[model samples]
Target chain A: MTPPSGPRKGRPRNADADGAILAATREALAELGWGGLTMGDVAVRAGVAKTTLYRRWPSKNELVVAAVAEQLDELEMADLGSLRADIEAVVAQFASLLSAPETQAALLALFAEATRDPLLRRRVREAIIEPQKRLVLAGRAAAQSRGELPLDTCEETASAAVDIIFDTVAGTVVHRMLVSGEPATPDWISSFATLLLAPLAGIGAGT
Target chain B: MTPPSGPRKGRPRNADADGAILAATREALAELGWGGLTMGDVAVRAGVAKTTLYRRWPSKNELVVAAVAEQLDELEMADLGSLRADIEAVVAQFASLLSAPETQAALLALFAEATRDPLLRRRVREAIIEPQKRLVLAGRAAAQSRGELPLDTCEETASAAVDIIFDTVAGTVVHRMLVSGEPATPDWISSFATLLLAPLAGIGAGT
Candidate 1:
């Protein structure tokens, strides 16, 4: 199904062109790295004109964020019978995403660049980091429904719990794969899930 | 401290020069970023000859690693009377180190570059990552001695537990400060330590 047309647009934006451009950006990142990638190269790869690329994404940072965000959106939490199973499944999915050459090459470089550019940092947070928190929320709700976790009463406390949980899950997987130079194997995932479950179920109970 | 000399070839290495070069590398990383940093510029900044810099570290990767490793070595875990206090103290220390402009600029970039270079990745694992795991070991031993944590019978299980704890602590802190673009304040640190304590104490007991 085609997305409904919106007001204040010149030509109806081409969804196919947008997909091609984002795909090209990821492909370029995998092959050329952040330093070597250029708008011209991406445009050529996407089979679009330079003007077209520029009209869509004003800078490399924005373009890369869009590409990475699209990929991150692929992360989803399913009710896998128990909190441990749900955690492990999502972790495995995340590990698989980070293990990709394109993601490995793009993510840290974007983050490194973001340290210097506040605008890019905000783009990264909004596009990539914020959306991924939904997994934590979804997981929490599923566990609560299953009686695996008590329902959180305070809104502020629940939000804080989500932040901590998101950081722990994402941070551990990233550090394990990117910094420690270790594979997030099934064994490692199982161990990590085990470590996380007790605390996860205990969140908002008091501490 | 200067009394002992190792058996090696050529003149004795200059400790002062090593310190200057590493310090200069960090300073340069803060100002110039990874892409802009060069060996010649670092040598000049350190008040050393290009040949001297080359003799010490063969590449930018090695120089950055040495600089980063030296800083990482400063991360020491004090007994601090209790497990939660120890964990929070070290988490604060790690967060402080990461909050520095030099470390912030260099670490993720080094990790990003290491993804494509196998030799650099090995150097990072050996120099930066492996040493930091000692903190986890120290914390665990202290906790066990205090009877806050149970002693593990299996060596392999103990090692696996260490890896999980290390990754969770370090990864959560890094993600919070760098990726999430949030401050790892005392409040956040206290909450994180609370969340970690129960699971950490239970690591090798069963799951």
Candidate 2:
């Protein structure tokens, strides 16, 4: 049974196999955490050859980025008409996504590891951060269109707000999750969202 | 001379040792980063002893917390009687302080580590967060008196904004420092200050 073509013909390369591997990575990250994750473990958990796993990703960080991207791509951004509504809607929903228990655990590890490694940091920015940044930038654009925010409103500022929401919630919620054995609730996200988003709506103008 | 144990002994614990140790901690944190710091190192740097250091503080986190506190405490809070002025002044200065390379590295390490260690997190919260919370609350109170930010504006949201600002500037600035080796300067801090504080004053009233 000789394989033909360029890097192909390997038991038909099951599409679902990639998905399962990612899911396993997510589970392992949640269960064992960042420092504990290993390619050998992921391979065993995925029922794949260590060679097969390495063929797909060169490093553990690569595997982590793939897992993050796949899990996160499923989260769609809201597109409410106005910037205020857009920000509010996105923030409201983001509150839920960010506070997800498994994701929270994985992200805590990612952020922590990023403190020590530069390559991993770039992967996070690329695989996880860029997409989220696009959403934030889109919301900022909507706000400008609705005339709620100044045209010159630095998207970076608004973008920073979104980052803040996730980071703080990540920090705060992870603290709660580890200590209390509970996921961060949506209500908590909503509370933080309102705090950060209100400024964009120009609500305190007269004041 | 094991005598004279009324209150304490050995040079009576020089009042300036605390300040000197804190200075040494900052210097070490800036030069070697957090992972490189130790009570022994701090003692050696400060011209003290391992025993004297332990007598004063228990752990590296505690020592770093003290250093962080000293630098941060010296900064003035903006209770300028106007929410706009108050927030601008307080946060502007915070961004400035965080912008410093040594301060940024030390604090980020402390905070990032806090995500994993509960005790350190608690100490950081106690020393840094509570006072900042008071500042935000007092600013809110000032707004209340002057009828600026709505009474209904979520306090957590307001606080999260502060948290986001602190962490984002830290993350972004440090990311830049690590990437570019450029020290965050007063100019960068002032620009960030102008971007956030000016818009933030409009918070509660928006949408």
Clashes of each: 0, 7
lDDT of 2 by residue, B1-207 (tens): 112453554556577788888888887776656545666787898998878777777666677788887787766656676655675576556556655656755765665555545666677777875565555556667777887655647767766555544443333443444322334455544444444454555533322
lDDT of 1 by residue, B1-207 (tens): 122556477677777998998899988887777767888899999999989887767777788888888888888898898888898899999999999988887887788777767787898888889888999999999988988887989999999889888888989999888888789999999888877876666544322
Off by over 4 Å in 1: A1-17, A38-55, A202-207, B1-17, B38-56, B202-207
Which candidate number has the best TM-score? 1
For model 2, report DockQ.
0.11
State the number of backbone clashes in model 1.
0
Task: List A-chain TM-scores for all predictions.
Answer: 0.88, 0.73
Against the true structure, candidate 2 reaches a TM-score of 0.60
lDDT of 2 at A117: 58
Report the lDDT tens digits of candidate 2 across residue range A1-207: 112444554455655668778888887776656545777898899988888777777777677778777777765557677644554466555546655545655665554444445666677777776676666657666666766667765657655466544443333433444322234355544444454444345445321
lDDT at residue B9 of model 2 (Cα atoms): 43
The 10-residue segment with the lowest total lDDT in model 1 chain B: B198-207
Specify the CAPRI tier of model 2: incorrect
List ranges where model 2 is wrong by over 4 Å.
A1-74, A80-85, A105-123, A140-207, B1-59, B141-207
Clashing pairs in 1: none
For model 2, state the Cα shift of residue B105 in Å: 3.1
In candidate 1, position B187 carries an lDDT of 94
For model 1, what is the alpha-carbon lDDT of residue A202? 56
